[model samples]
Target chain A: MKIVAIDRQGKEHTLEGRDGWTVMEILRDGGLDIAAECGGACACATCHVYVNDGWFEKLPAPSESEIDMLDMALAVEPNSRLSCQIVCSETTDGIKVTVAPE
Target chain B: MTAAAPIETDVAIIGAGPIGLFAVFELGLLDLKCHLVDILDRPGGQCTELYPEKPIYDIPGLPIVTGQELTNRLLEQVKPFNPQFHFNEMATGLEKLADGRWKLSTDAGTTLIVPVVVIAGGAGSFVPKRPPIPGIEVFENAGDGVGVHYAVRKMENFRGKNILIAGGGDSALDWTINLAPLAKSLTLVHHRDGFRAAQHSVNQMRELEAAGKIKFHVASVKALHGEAGKLASVTLAGADKSEWHHETDAFLPFFGLTIKLGPIAEFGIHLNENLIPVDTAKFESQTLGIFAIGDINTYPGKLKLILSGFHEAALMSQAAFHIVRPNEKLRFQYTTSSSSLQKKLGVS
Candidate 1:
């Protein structure tokens, strides 16, 4: 599965990761600047990312707690989602996202 | 006399929670000495504060253990390291010293110069949650230090005064029982007759109330009245909203605690909301020589579990080793395989 992440610097990097691991794990393993503070528990908004327009709708809707955590994320947008809540799967192979500012 | 010199160490750890205590073992394995600072008067953090008797099931091999029991075992495991502990103080500032070592200062004026700083504070520092009493701040102790008090820093200050202690928590009950004889008259105020303190403490409080030594008011504090910032009387509202003025000299509200990012926010490290962001490999923040583990830190795919913090501590200690001793080579060894490490643990 290939997932692309644009860091705070706007430099894009494509990553190949296995299924079952979260988008957060793929991004961190791909050596990007993502802070999944609560470690995929949907407890913190550190792993927040702005999903590209086309990819945002394809992902599952965030839960109540995820939305609450997103409320605390800085620079939140309509497409903002906690990367840890986005698990890796076949449909999410070509997703694109931008890392939120620190 | 000149002020005492700041304490120095190889690693200055914040928070003596389970993760902080575990970091002592991991860092000790690498021969890195550590000094811990925490805001609470006691160690164990949430375990002791929130739930001491509640059984936890997910702590590795321990099938079913209470929070306090787990803390006790961890304390025993790390005892061989002899880590220095600074309790009842909050780490308030972090600055780069002239010699390249970091100088960390606490609220109590204790300072320590450490080459590597480890933050294991679980959800940051614990700050007491102030009750929602209108204008209570007005009587929160003025020039002579008498009126409203959150914590009894000095029990002697309330001697021979009419004291009104609110809330049903341990702090309220403990102080109610301890300060009964000291105060001219004491009143235990709560919304209901039930209390959250230990049974022994509650029973002791009841005994005092029965003997008419201390009055028990099944009510809540509504308003404070005083002159010159001195507490004169407190209006207690009953369940039916019936208010009555009770003559009191001092008011103490022990409403419990809420965690805050506190002074660590001033450390100049990158913060995601309130947690420190770190690299998964080293668990070190964007800043060099500073590591964050436990619930205090954030990374991609981070889990706030104690087991995860324990894993992070091991990796963080490895990364901290180089910064602490640049000239020495790091040789990884297992406790089961390395005899020297076993000797250090007093097991060999």
Candidate 2:
């Protein structure tokens, strides 16, 4: 699957991920430096990222804990979701996410 | 050599995790001495305790490695230096001594004198806080068989069982989402309807509830019912003065633990939400001779990764060495031949 991550500098890097890996793992393994403190357990909000507006509906809804973590994130938006909690699937292909500025 | 005041070693490391161990390894390469301390009976800090079995896909060189194996590799890398280790002892307090030595007190009533302390605690010792529900204190020593659980690393523990999850935060939701597929029945109860997690997770839970994959309760656990010494059901009361009882086999409360900064806070260290603030490049704290590393240190552009912590430790060791021996030239000399070799290897 293809996931686009926009960094703080507005540079977008399209990463490839398997169906099972989360967005946080895909971005991190690709050297984008998205901090995921809880290792995708959704225990920490460090992996907060914002999804493109229209694309938000294309993905599964985040759990309540992911929303709680977005509250603690730096640049939270209505589309903010913890990247670790966003698991990739065939339906999530071509998803667009942006790493919020710290 | 001219006789001067007794100069202690360059740096003192306050943890033996990946960051602290990396500091030792780097400083040893620089031919500097380091003293490392940790409360864990062994090294690896949070990695050893929190997710020993989880495979780490990051960390530049290795494709994958378990937390325990990673810790072992780091220990092996630092073994050559013979860095002094103070294990099973927590650093209770820190004070700058008259001779410029850092005096550290342990909970065991022991004291250590060193220079340049590096606070490399990953989430400050990884002490899991138990929920404050009544009767929880009574079940503290009943082991995992009873209704007491300190952590939930895997979802299979609750699979095919009726599970009740508490807390309205990200961990609680993540657990709910993960277990919704495997659990026989799942109920998520929180203190408030508004969740403090990511918006997407909240949306996902609503969708899951709509699809009948799980049930959501806007309340907290008032009472837990047990049968034959194991959890059987949970009673949740809503804010609207409504109550419901659900039979459950496991009750996994994901309310985030209350993290304590402990004695490190007393060292006059600067912090943001209990996280020590450090210079991202140098890993040095506000106070001289006090450096912070790993997850505990927060700063602009601070990426809290094990690999990033390793980088911070390496740089901090060099800075600490300069602080201790300002006049001494370090052993590693960048000769023209070595520079050419580095160039050949595509290293700057």
Best by TM-score: 1
Looking at model 1, residue B9 earns an lDDT score of: 89
Error of 2 at B243 (Å): 10
Q: Per-residue lDDT for A1-102 in model 2, tens only?
A: 899889878998999977999889999898886656667866556677889958888788877656655534433446778888888899888999998654
List where candidate 1 sits over 4 angstroms from the true fold. A1-102, B1-3, B141-145, B198-212, B226-228
lDDT computed for candidate 1: 0.83
Q: Give a tens-digit lDDT track for model 1, residues B1-348.
A: 233489988999999989999999999999999999999888798777656676778899999998799889989999999999999999988999888899998878889999999998888777765555678788875533268887887888888888888877678899999999989999988766776567899899989988999999777787889887878898888867788999988888876565677889989999997889999999999889889998889878887788999999999999999999999999999999999899989999
Top candidate on DockQ is 2
Kindly report, for each predicted structure in the order presented, the TM-score of its chain A compared with the true chain A: 0.95, 0.93
Instruction: Put down candidate 2 lDDT per residue, B1-348, tens digits, no spaces.
Output: 232333345666788888888888777766668777687778887677556777888989899998889999988877767888878777778888898778776675556666777888776653444554556554444433235565665556666777777777677788888889988888887755778777899999999999998988767676777754567777777777688887777777664433355778777877787888787678888888888888889888877788888888878877877877778875554424566434433444
User: Candidate 2 DockQ score?
Assistant: 0.08
Residue-wise C-alpha lDDT for candidate 1, range A1-102, written one tens digit per residue = 889899989999989867988888899878897756444556446677999969999998987667655534543456888998898899998899999765
Q: Which stretches of candidate 2 lie over 4 Å from their true place?
A: A1-37, A41-102, B1-10, B134-259, B333-348
